[model samples]
Target chain A: MNRTTTEKVVKSLKQRHRKEKLFKAAGFASVCFGFLLVLTLISDIVIKATPAFHQHWLKLEIDYQQEWLGVDSLDYEKLESADYRKVLRRSILAMMPEVSGRQDKRSLYKLVSNNAEFTVRDALLKSPEFIGKKKNVWVMLDDDVDSYLKENTEFSQTGIRISEKQAGWIEQWYNNGLIDKQWNTEFLTSGDSREPELAGVRGALTGTMWTMLVTLILSFPLGVAAALYLEEFAPSNRFTDFIEVNINNLAAVPSIVFGLLGLAVIINLFGMPRSTPLVGGVVLTLMTLPTIIIASRASIKAVPPSIREAALGLGASKMQVAFGHVLPLAMPGIITGTIIGMAQALGETAPLLMIGMVAFIVDVPMGVTDASTVMPVQIYLWADSPERAFLAKTSAAILVLLTFLMMMNTLAATLRRKFEKRF
Target chain B: MKKLPIILSLIATSSNLMAAGRDTISVVGSSTVYPFSTVVAERFGKTTDFKTPKIESTGTGGGMKLFCAGAGIDTPDMSNASRRIKKSELEMCEKNGVKEVTEVLVGYDGIVIANSKATKQMEITRKEIFLALAKQVPATDGSEKLVDNPYKTWNEINPDLPKTKIEVLGPPPTSGTRDAFAELVLEGGCEQFAWIKAIKKQDKNKYKAICHSVREDHVYIEAGENDNLIVQKLTTNPKALGVFGFSFLDQNSDTLQGSIVDGEKPTFEGIADGSYPVSRPLYFYVKNAHVGKVPGIKEFLEEFTSEASMGEEGYLTDKGLIPLGEAKLKKIRDQVLSFTPLKL
Candidate 1:
């Protein structure tokens, strides 16, 4: 009511307003920093990986001379063992007649991949009609040449991977329109290789699919049953409480420990095959069981008690009431939780490595029992490779893995938003 | 709850279907020796009726530990090693009842100091490299007292060198290549200090710690087992150098250049003929107990030691293995065929 008191109150109010403004700005800055960090990480992976999706190719004419190939007939066996390497060399020499001597010839051959002969042989074997004929085919270029075309390094570097002569040849080919860039579909469709350019995620991808399938098949029924019995049927006694606490604790165990368990119990004790998707799946099933059970129980608990009472009041038994009414109501949440758990299992590497899935398998697995690796393990292998080209391949693998995780997460979010009931 | 019984039955049926067998050979050891063993295993699998050997790239120390664990069907049949087994490891094997073991000498590998091709080639001496990388160096004024490394740039060690910063990306202490580098390059240079050489006579362990320890400064980074990362990092920072195997240098010669150490380049011939100073022989130890029990152990060893595999013009050489001379190769091959146990 006094003038001095009124002045004091106004000053305090002004200071409080300034403080609130500062807090708001700080909160905004922190959020922006977190968002910027994610953006930088994603963009860094994308920019580095974009080159891996597009591989370079060189168009060349092959004479396929019988004498040069050491094959007089079109027998598949003879063709497979034929000296296609010599024919390939002669073809490259024919293209650049000016290049001479052993060293120069070797440099000229370096423009094409060491696997070119195999490619040419495979193409011929598939079509015996092409034998003894001059054919123009687009062959995959060497990894170094591919890197050069992608401008991964400067053009005029003297001592870098690309020599001056090789650079000049590439420049001439570019001008002549003999160089081509195409989507690297093989990266998606083939298996792993010692050569970076030839390596693909097909084996790892299939292995992951099989492993996840096994995990889902094993964990889903077992997890749901456990949850249903505990939440709906089992009495809340000391034993039930002990089981609930242990499940929560198990969920917190590091994934690598599960790997050690799989190594010891699954592979060593049970005498199961190591490095197979079967073992990887079994290990992942154990890892994801706690998560799935916890989620299923939460969802089962979310269902209103009124629904169960209503079903029971309609003369249905306890099993019908729980399975018919309560289970249907909790379906959406259960599915979403399962998806998230599956995603977590999909990105696991250490446990699989412990089970010996780190083997360099070059064949796409045809069955769960076959030797296989998962996507994360493939990334680990490539990331550890000493080849420079594998650097881009590793980033590309990360991009692919991130996309898969995002897709799964998005699906879970959509399921929850579309079907989850508030009440 | 009804689903529980069905799942349990399914697991029981699957477990019944799976059986135990030890028909295949199991190999474990140094990552450096993994590729060669894998190649031999692949070839053996194709040419013979035997199953391809299962190989794991556990480090040399870890491999020796596993190899010496025992000599049973469950134990690994062989272990690839970048370094010779120590007396302690042999004694551990003996204590564990792994009495008979055969040591097969594979070819050699050269550890290389390389940089991105964009930089000028550096011809460095062992003493200069020691001063640049060692944790401690003799005081620069030629006193006998040891002091923390004070040089920040390559030129500080030798004025004739370039003024570029002393940045090196290398393997951690666990790597066998790191051990070879410390032994050959660091010790080779440490001996140039007469006082340090005399210290070795009085106390070998202290002398080793003094010579082998690298600086903890940011100038020397410990890149883990991923050598490709070092190559990629070098490309981005042209002034930085990397330490890796000669095979990596051979594969990425277009983008990288090996530095001249002790006036010799890390060429295959130089390494094979003993001109290259930082080279070491690679080996693999076979458990004689498993040789008869495990299928294809002896056959795989025979395939590996054949002239076609270990010869100068062998497939392993194409993969960057420096082959021994014909006379030495024959001697080692004869010894391996006879199953001569290593006398440790």
Candidate 2:
């Protein structure tokens, strides 16, 4: 009886243990499935979108019209439409290999691309006197054919994706030295716009760059100054404690709330235009100030007190010791803190949107006061565009923006690694 | 766990029920039309007891995307638009087995270029406005640069105007306001130029490019559709003009004033008479398929055409709309009432 009962009990216990292991395995498998799903989704997005970064070039070998060669101001207003088109057509034709006869007229004309007449008209507008003049000019092909050869899409006929028909002609044109693959700096450099083909982030990039420059200019000094006052000068009292709490709270405030604050304060009270990067930078500086200050204070605090004592022992004043010895030791930390703060500002969009940076600006921003777009805003704009091509463009923009953020982070890390022990 | 199963089963049952007596309707796109549909649905809901209609303001293009997805769960009832549907969009709808759609233009919304009270006196012409605010323009000398003298400011762009800066606050590309402005202002202004019109006609992208580039750094601010934000900014920054629909102007008229375009102030009467060149139509597309099952949509659509819905002081008009002309409004309403689905 004992042997039989014992064997049955042991087998039942074993079954229970097996069930538990099976449940754990199922749980692990479910998690793996979820991870695989995300991986597949991400890979699909990256693969489908990578093409947006590359653009095809349509090489035109058109002889610039001698009439419109070097435009003079005299004929600027007098330049006729036909005159401009003549130059444009010639340049476009030159971009494509000439055909013996009229059979290649349509295809050849298509090949000389950047068919955006605005650019041609834009060219003509620049050199109105050049209408009668002609010379060889290479121009960007249309966005559609360019994107197609660039493999941004499935080689479609339009909207940055070169038309399949255009692709066929382009194959011949490429063989004959017409449209070719060229690096698309426009994709990386231009601001977001309604037109996906002509879209570039240069405007936003410059806007972002200047905004960061200003933010670092304003925030780093002020933050370091504040951190010094708090860490080195201010006694650990109620007022200082209150200031500390407020800074922490400011850091925790939602970014959009900061946007509202910017709308209410920087743009409203100060009367700054909505899209001025000055406003964007100022708003972002306010947002990042607490970060900078916090980092600065931490960095300042990290400097060994013994260094300050050593400097003071050599008959140096407290100010000199703090500025010379302690400050140098804190430089790497300060730089790292400043870079992180600036990096955080770089990707910010909410405040920019509120202040009107979401709008389209063509040329790159020249100053803080200039109307601008930022990289994130460009990303936002492209992501929200109804054009399917914009989806790819947005992802491409994302890659570039991520690259920028990564570069900043890498720089910060390198600085920290390089200088952390030197001091 | 027991109640959970019951809830899931109920959800599944409702999912099955979604295929009601050919009566469920989904109208997507155009926040501009949302308020009207909501009221229409309310009155219709009280009457039909059919399925409730669902509306989404995914903008005109985004709405078209769903509407063009074709028949079934993915397909929408009707796509409301603030502008004319593109040929490509129409072709997509057709390809998606949505051959027949009732396109109804309800009322009118004169696209109003407004500004804070400080900017009320600043009158502008299409050319100056375009130059000052467009992303970029076809330079006469051909070098693309920030428009130095788009229409040479107010007086140059047009003969009669004030000497105010051309800083404009506008909707982002994601809005119906953007579409209306693109079509009504930028495209229309570009058309005014014979050379630009020719360029546009020759290669649409060139036209699109010119249209897209009002000017880069100096002109045009891409303000997203928080018209309130534009209004707020306008109130404080008098030099900046806000480009939004007439609805915004009507709401903020106490603090802001309509921008005079080409010496014509945008008003309901002016829009109707074509005196206001920036006037555009307001639209609502109904889900014809959801008429029966969706108790509200059919009735709501029917109510939309009624005088109560679109009269001069109608609820919709009161909501800051510039009412369409009596004749045009009636015609569109009649079209909505008379529309019937063709037999497959």
Candidate 3:
């Protein structure tokens, strides 16, 4: 080789290495940028959510006077129908004897939650022995008090929801060690409430469970059967091509169109109940079916035809070969597809909005036919609520939802790894 | 495959149970009135033995469609509206076998035009607001012709106003807040022009079209139903203004300030007393046919109209609901109690 040719080759090699180095650097930078963005988002949500996990409780001495409760005896019926709100008000007011004006008394009574009366009533019902006895109880503080305490513990400045007098009272309570922070168990146990502090995601969680159960049961078998027919049995013809193209197109259609279709057909035509998980699941099934079918068909196509030939050579019929060999091989991929589809359905709020699931339902739905709202809708509602504490609640709910999605994806990955056959 | 049949049968049975009859009262209505109604529903549920009513926050028109669909167990028992039922809607209800409905006058909701606390509170007149936000304004040449809104900034409309771009974030035309604002503020200001006032006598539709159309320019942004987002945006952009229900302003008072419209500040007392001009009455109509069919319809009405829920010192007040006046409350209570069919 000539010296000039060798020099030329060396020069090109250096330039090619430089270009290659630059490309790799660019790729690494993009990946790092993506990670940084996700990290910032998750950290911001976590910081906002941490405040919602703990709630403030005010310690108060409550004299459970049978007379105050308007119950002559500790009869269950009388206790059930008692005016516990009055007793709670009297106990809170007894703490601040100096407050006598109507407005001052109102602010003082606002220290505890309006729902705290149920706590007192339940305690009385559990222990009839406490009647006419002064017991020290840790009453739940109002959402405003909890928010103010969490935001401005020093009470140097008044809060948006907390007035100056309310701040002062909270400070007094804090200094006297009457205020304590406890895990917000109500946020997990109870149903939705108008009060931000009392609101819980149990109802939404169960609604999601029921809806997902319905989606799984309906979409899985239907999707797998269609995929199997197309991949193994259907002759390659114009009809099959049309079905294939339409399935792909349906997979690309916006989810809200399915919601409109559900509204028109399911609720309007079929006379289905509105705002029920049954309707929501049915709508989501329509939205998910195409994706599941496409994925399952691809997975089934990836199965080796040699296996099918071998099964047929062993005197097995076509049906037995497809079901026994191809299906077992494609099961892992099909499940992964279904999980992804379920995740998509789990995050959907628009389709549910059309069918009245974007509601303020207070009761935890007992069945699929009962009216319910899902987790995403609950987050949307909390974000739109007028209360200041709901901001943290919204972030907390998002955190819960993100955790749920992660767990589902992890389950899908684990199942894939366990069942995936390399051959 | 066996599991599939079991699931299908389960769904069929559950749906059959739901279709048989609904025991709980179902309420659908305006998002504007949802907060107040939900509070009342929750209170009623806790205080009584009846199941909690399911309330959907469909817009007023959507709620009316559902409420007036028919008289049956499948239809909603009550429809809440931020405005009175239109004559056409009443006719449709009558046509659909909903021969009778009792309209309960819920309290009022005030719409406020607010800005960030960083900026001074806006003292705006209806005419000035109309001139700033309307797609077409009266000609500045003192003629009876309409011209494109040429004023680019607040100071151009009025010299005393701040020298900032006239960017107003507000709800879309679909929102009840937008409806009330167009009717009360825009029309109120649009009528001040002598020629336009004369036009109202000639062609009511022309007057309404002129007055109701908000500007399509970038100055007027159709912020979605999320008022909290608007509040957040206003804090970041100090010069911008937002229109929303009074409850949002009350909740975010630390960062937002309500504008003074027509010399009256958007305060609770001012709005409740009718001094604030941009307030609208919220209403809920009950299907008289479902009064006895639904187990808790009558009891729920009584609880909603009770003094503790709708009174001056009621819990609703704490949630930013302005209570009705004494005489109006009494009249509404009597109407709710007697279930007198609405004449309209």
The estimated TM-scores of all candidates read: 0.83, 0.48, 0.98
User: Comparing 1 and 3 by DockQ, which wins?
Assistant: 3
TM-score of 2: 0.48
- Predictions in order: lDDT: 0.84, 0.66, 0.91
lDDT, candidate 2, A1-423, per-residue tens: 999999999989988999999999999999999999978866776886776766666544334454654344345444323344455565655544444455455444544432344355556566655444553344666544554565433333443223355566666766677555656677765544444565776777778787886687678778999988898888898998999999999999888888888878876576554466667878898988998899888989988888888888889997898788777788788888788788888888877755656554454655565556788877775554433456678777777787788888897888777766654
| lDDT tens readout by residue for model 3, A1-423 | 699999999989989999999999999999999999999999999999998899999888888887888888777999898888888888888877777899888888888998889888888888878889977887889998888888884787898778898888888889999999999988888888899889999999889988998898889989999999999999999999999999999999898999999999999999999999999999999989998998899899999999999999999999999889999899998998899899999999999988999988889998899999999999999898988889899999999899889988998899888888878
| TM-score of candidate 2 chain B vs. the reference | 0.83
CAPRI quality level assigned to candidate 3 from its DockQ score: medium
Docking quality level of the chain pair in candidate 1: acceptable
Clashes of each: 4, 65, 0
Residue range B1-344, candidate 2, lDDT tens digits: 34645544653464354334334345667766655554454434333445444444456776787677666543556777887777787777778777766777777777888866754466667766666566655565654433444543555444556665557788887888787788778777767667777776589987787775556564578777656567667888887777876765664565778877888988768886778888777765554544454345546676677775676656466445666667777877777777753222
Worst 10 residues of 2 chain B by lDDT: B15-24
Q: Per-residue lDDT for A312 in model 3?
A: 97
In terms of docking quality, model 2 is incorrect
